[model samples]
Target: MLRCHEVTIQVPGRVVCDHLSVVFEAGQVWAVLGRNGAGKSTLIHTLAGLARPAAGSVELQSTDESARGARARARIVGVLLQIEDGTYWGTVAEYVLLGRFPHSHPLMGYSRDDIEHAEAALDALALTTYAGQRFATLSGGERQRVRIAQIIAQRPRLFLLDEPLQHLDLAHQARVLDLIATRAREHGAAAVMVLHEPLWITRSCTHVLVLAGDGTAHCGPADEVLTRERLEHAYGCRLREVDYGAGRSFVPDV
Candidate 1:
């Protein structure tokens, strides 16, 4: 479990959220929803102990008060940011293998188990063909897939993804999201992703976290929190829900 205790987060010009407390459980997929610049990424960074909160604290499942919390958290938490700098000058395999650093022995080369995990992750993401290719040469979507493969190879207990499908086609989007969900359930891990699409939330997530862009946030089960009104309030737009076969879909009333 990841617990935030009365956390307050703010940006240089805007307050993101104030005194917000929430808990994320294992084996559950949660979607973080908000408009642009609502601090969705900031909140995720804070959860990963990459950013400092204004007043409160984030407690990871591993409560090893002896060692540095951030180091301990990394052993259990996996983070995928929205973008990556193109400065890395290495092959795809080398980049993906970096994820296994937390598990491998220091100063020693990657073990056979680590190599197998990296290979399996590449195979899962269909990136085996690009293993020897330079990371800078891959297209944006391809790079995204490789990063996803890296995190999968890491196999952390919790996954924090920000706009993970930014550069993917429809098929890859579904495939990646499904893969995350399947891996989460199979490993009893947790996923908290920042996404713009409500369709993915409905299909892949069990919980919802909506930042209203007004220094406030709401969270609950997906079914209870993803109503048209809640979405409209979070997005500040008119929306309508329509029955899509047996399920439903939300569209803007414009």
Candidate 2:
């Protein structure tokens, strides 16, 4: 499981979350919701151990033993950021192969199992044909999918995705989310995704964490915490839930 204890995350002149704590269990999906500049990314990074917390601690304890240090932690937590920042001069296949580095020995190359995992991830993301294509040549959406594919290839115990739906069309968004949810359930992995549209927190997510942008946060089961009041408070705007008998839809009150 992945857990944070009284963790405080803050940047210069900006506060994301203060003395916050949460835990993510296997076979569950959690979404982080809030307005822009609400320190969503900062909080995600802190939880993933990519960034240091101002106070307290973040720990990951496997079912049997503990994986200590950065290298061991990397073997368990897979992170995908909002943007693919660095310039890559390699093929899509080559880039995806990097995900296996955590499990490899020093000065080691890709093993047969590693290649197989990368190929499976590529197939799952419908990028098998593009495997030979240059990573830089792919479009924004394509690059985003490849980035996600890399994570799948890693086969980590916990997934940390920040704004994963960026640069994708509606179809790809749904497709990618489906794959993420399926993978988590099948592998008994825990997924924590940062999403912009709270409305898209589909049935796949079991829990939620909403940042109020006021140095506070709220969390609970999805059905209980994803109410209009909580969402409006987090976004600092008025929104209404329209009842359509079978379900409810979230939209602006206007």
Candidate 3:
């Protein structure tokens, strides 16, 4: 499990999220839902260890109390950020191979197992044919797929993805989320992702964490916290939650 205790985050002069606490357990897909500038990305960065919390501690279940939690998180969490600003320099396969850095050796080099894992991840994200293509040359959506493939190659116990479906089309969005869902179940890992699309969250997540302004959360099972009332309260606007079982969807209340 991945947990945050009394976590607070602040920017230069503003307290974005305050005293936030949440737990992500194995066999659960969690959606961190909120509106723009609600500190959703900040929370994800904190959990990923890319940004330090103003005050709080993050813990991984398997580690000792005295163990360095930051280092442990780095090893156990595979993160996908909201943006990829810097240009990538390598091929899709090479970029995916980078995920094995924590386990690779200079002299021994990348093993066959590592190559197989990277290849499998590429295949999973439907980027196999683009394996040899330059990362910088792919379209934005295609690049996002490669990024997801890299994280899949990492095979971490905790997955933190920030707005992972932003640039993806309907088909790729479902495919990618399904891929993450399958991997999390197969490995008994915890998957926590931030999303703006209510329909996707309702359909893809087992647990949902709704973030309101000033750092409040209404978190629970998908069917509970994803209701019209809760979503309107969280996003400060009305919403309509629709159910279609296998093909569930949601729309703006207004």
Query: What are the clashing pairs of model 2?
Result: none
**Can you write out model 3's per-residue Cα lDDT over 130-166, one digit (the tens) per residue?**
9999999999899998889888898887889998887
Question: 181-236 in candidate 2: lDDT tens per residue?
Answer: 88778888888999877556844678899998988988778888788888888888
**TM-score preference between candidates 1 and 3, better one:** 1
Write down the worst ten-residue block by lDDT for model 3. 64-73
Enumerate residue pairs that collide in model 3. Answer: none
Assess each prediction's global lDDT (C-alpha) against the native.
0.89, 0.86, 0.82
Clashes of each: 0, 0, 0
Once fitted onto the true fold, the runs of candidate 2 whose alpha carbons sit more than 4 angstroms away are 64-66, 243-246
Give me the candidate number with maximum TM-score: 1
Please give the lDDT score for candidate 2.
0.86
Q: For every model shown, what is its TM-score relative to the native structure?
A: 0.95, 0.95, 0.91
> What is the descending TM-score order?
1, 2, 3
